[model samples]
Target: MNVVLFNPRAQKAHRRLPLSLLMLARVLDCEWALVDGNVEPGAEQRLDALCARPGTVLLVTVMPGPQLGVATPSCRRLKARYPGLTIVWGGYFATVYPEAAARDPGVDFVVLGQGERTLPELLDALRAGGDPTAVPGVAAWRDGGLVRGPTRASVRPADFPDPPYERLDMERYAARTFLGDRTYNHHASAGCPYFCNFCAVVNMFEGKWIPDPADHVVRIVRRLATEYRADAIEFHDNNFFAWEKRVVEVSRGITDLGVSWWGEARIDTMLGFSGATWEAMARSGLRMVFFGAESGDQDAIDGMEKGGLTVEDTRALNRLARRHGIRPEFSFVLANPGDPERDVERSLALVRDLKADNPDCEIILYMYTPVPLPGMYDEATKQGFALPKTIDDWLSPEWAGYDRRRNPRTPWITPGLVDSVYDFETVLHARYPTVSDLRMGPWQRRALRALSAARWRLGWMKAPYELRLLQKAWGYRRPEEMGF
Candidate 1:
């Protein structure tokens, strides 16, 4: 029997470590092949070769956007060619919407939540001719309906084995970004602790966070620096700063390694970190942090249950990050379901304020996309927002765009309003081109800033055709899209 691990291609410049597959590889007590679609030119060919034998299991990690688009077609083609092939879908999409994958004729099983413990058991059941869905965190198609096992939180990261870096081509995973030429990625923590209603994490993890100890994180960092010569590390955790002491310890231990790091943290949580902790973070080369200043309105923040985060917290963090020389990349969700236009205007005003407070600060603007949880999702459902019933429907252009949060066409937001939000973003990008684009040099940066200066100042952001053309010519990528 042959086992293969697959990560569907996300997009260009989106190559990072396939952490999900690596974690599963460490625990799977069998010979397996790992193929990363992002780096492997012959990913499908390699998968076909591995999955030729009888009882071959192909495990795929899929996200909601571009990855789903590619994986859907690939799985359909493979299933049609090999009747004995077993396809299993995991990752964010599978956990959040298991029926979408389980209902698909190509996918035989769906792994929910975490897979370090569940996947091996499911494979054993399949080999023994037993019920695969009996394994916790496994979902499968039985008869004509979907049979889902019990959902649970992720297991402890400490119990997992060391990263299986030897199994992968580290040079391919190493990426060029604002941090360094050879930036790599790691997920040191389990799910996030807070339950932001609009966030997809809630649907899967239900507000639980488990992190590896500080010493363990230090060991990994040292190994990456000494063995792989990695100059930077990006923590792909849902929230890396959940435990203050762990972050402080990790920061101090990694200081001498000279590796710049970045991670996501809640504004309210980081604002509570002591001055000493901030000093430790700065000394350890904490280059940047991503915060979900979700909305400019305090009411919306409260409604979303962001763990008591306030609009003022966002402002204070911007100042604090400036003081520590750590750049703040703030992402705002524009156009709330209720009063979409007003929500956007308030957020735009806050964006201006954030830029004024810290000119070097980065801003990411995303249209509001509802997850399957309460609060906003209920509002969305009332406004005719519904999940697709079949995998093919998810591959449609509108649903694909919805997954990316760039073009979600919620009924609440009007076409005119969407255009206005995008126009504002275009001007914002022109005036403050992201520093992440290593190719944009001094003169190019100056030209962009100068060209969009008048429109930004006069608040005339409508129809900035010149700015759009120049951006396209330069091939600019926004900070949000760059995984900042």
Candidate 2:
């Protein structure tokens, strides 16, 4: 059976290829094609082109929260055109809400958790004219009811090959950096060890961390550098520094290849490394590292069950990273459960302090968005926040995940606070534009700042989607920068 995989475009066109779809394609036994909606003119055109070909038995669409809405209409259109097409939904969104996802008429199956093994197994069954219900980690509709199955075990990273970048138009991809032209995205591991209450990663991976062999990761890096002519690499792992020794080994391996790289890590994990270890990583070309400094106040951190993390820890780590010639960037959440006004101020103060200490340091500020994860969704529900009750709810344009830039307010976050926190972040983005923001010109930068100030002053403004439109009009963003 011929299988087609679709990746709906983000709000902005992204150069980084979809790794989940790539991985799924890697293990599939039948003829398969990957259609990226992000680069295409429209999702409908892409789907129509694929469906025009005969003998296409199955269609798969991967959902990252933001693109779920974009995929809904395209799936419906394709189903109408090709009634025989078996539409399957997978990836982060389906893993969390299989039943709700299956409720959508366009979606015939929902592959929960990981899809590498599950997808191939399901396809094999379909090819044999066997019951798809026998496949684990899949939810399908049968007899007017949803049939759900247990998730399959996570696969070792070593067992899977690097993403199938050869299937994509590599030249069409570009990184966000000035040097992003030759940049590529990669992952040496899957899943996170920590269960940060607000994070859906833990729920998606069932709190299990699976890492690839260090040597194998080194080989992949070397291949990327040698074959793809990649000058830079971004390790997209959520917890790259989970094991200090493993990180050191990987860093040294990359250093030997003479390629500069960046990745994200928890602050405590970075602190856990000794001075010499960090120095080794820095010397090896670890140019930047990101930490989830979720909030500035300890109470806010505790409220999120972000264990043992403190503002002090954040300050120390940023300082140390700068000392070692590694740029430190942070992500701060302005609104959280029970965060008093003072707590928000503390977070802003920390952002200012980081910039003052090292103007080069990057700070990304975000309002607390309620996603359908256990700890976060449950708490938000208690606070009178309603979770998306069905697939249609998730596909709603106003869904919180659609656009973080626009208003996606939680019940706990008053409209005034959302405006305040967003205005604060916009100012910071103007002052210390991240290293990746090398393309924005001075005129555009000033315009963004002025726009932010105007929105903030007009506190009565209910919803502001125009700012995002303005940002695009000014050529400040890539097609993949914003979610659709």
Candidate 3:
């Protein structure tokens, strides 16, 4: 069997490792080829040469928003050209909308959540000229109907083979970031324990969480540090700090490696960490952390079932991170269903308070785009919102921005509200340019800060044309736009 895994163009010249495809490659029993559009020029042309064979399987890892738009047409043309080729779609986009993905002309098979198990099974069936749709966690349009197997969720990363990083040019993925000169990304964990109803992780993991053992994680990090000369690492796990013991162990192992690192965590969970754990994290060179501080209202947070996180908890976590000298970047889901106005008002207020409490804390404001789940999505439905049922519909101008998390096209959120959020974000970022933006000079930073100081302090987030002009002129990179 000829299996070629393709990572569609996601970011612009961003050197991100495709850990998803690498994981699948590790477990594949047959020979396979890998092409990353992020790094490879003429990625589709390479696929064309590799996929011209009679029994070729073109596996693609797709994300929800922009990547889906990118991969759809590419795969469609590939399929149209080589009608004998088999195209399989995997990753968050396929897992979230398996049936819809199956209905697409390009996607022949949709691999649900964890592909380590299901993908091999589906391949075994396909190799035997058997029914691929019969495999568990596989979905396909067959015999004029959509056939879907049982739903799949999270699994242990340790149970699988290590990511086959040796297959690719490690130097291609070694990009410089705020953490250090050369940075590489790793997903050490599989899922999140808590199910934030609006989160796609909850839908993929079903409230289950799993992480590779501390020793395994440290081994990989050690290799990246020693062999690849990576001075920093980013743990792209859904929840990197899911288990504190493993975190401490990993931290202890990496303490002497001298590699700066970053990860994501929950506000309430980290607040419960002992001082010893906090110290270990700091000594490990943990520089920054991301948190889903979903809302500013305690009641609203409680509604999201974020493990009893209060409005005060975000503030407390900010202080904790500050004490540890680790910057905390909070992502807020604004203009949520029902009472969208109140949601925006309270969340933006909290953003201001957070900045005041800790100058280093970063605020990422996102419009609430619901996953196809219960709770908030039901509310979104009540307020006239629905997920696109086809690939083309998802590419439409209104829905294309859906996964960017800034401009949600839900009816409850007016254009004024979206602009208000953008305006405030512009002023806020101008006042405090992101440290992730290393290209920004001291003069430009001082100028932006001075110009936006009055607007930020006076709560004047209207238009802010001056800030926009400077940001456009200087090519300022907001942390949100940069995907930090």
Q: Write down the TM-score of every candidate.
A: 0.98, 0.89, 0.98
lDDT of 2 by residue, 356-385 (tens): 677777777666766676676687788788
> What is candidate 1's lDDT per residue for 1-484, written digit by digit as tens?
5789998888667588888889998988878999888889998898888888788899999998888888998898889999999999999999888888898988999999889989889989988999888888999878878898787557877688987999788888788888988898888888898888889988778888989999999999898988999999999888999999999999999999999999999998999999999999999999999999988887777767788898899999999999999999898887777677777888899999999999988898888888889898888899787888788899886687888797777778888988998999999999999988776778878999999999999999999999999888877888867742
Give one digit per residue, the lDDT tens place, for model 3 in 209-277: 888899999999998899889899999998999888999999999999999999999988899999999
Query: After best superposition, candidate 3 residue 158: deviation in angstroms?
Result: 1.7
Q: Give the better candidate number (2 or 3) by lDDT.
A: 3
Candidate 2 C-alpha error for residue 55, in Å:
5.1
Pairs with steric clashes in candidate 3? none
Candidate closer to the true structure by TM-score (higher is better), 2 or 3: 3
lDDT of each: 0.88, 0.73, 0.88
Say which prediction, candidate 1 or candidate 2, comes out ahead on lDDT: 1
Deviation (Å) of 361 in candidate 2: 1.4
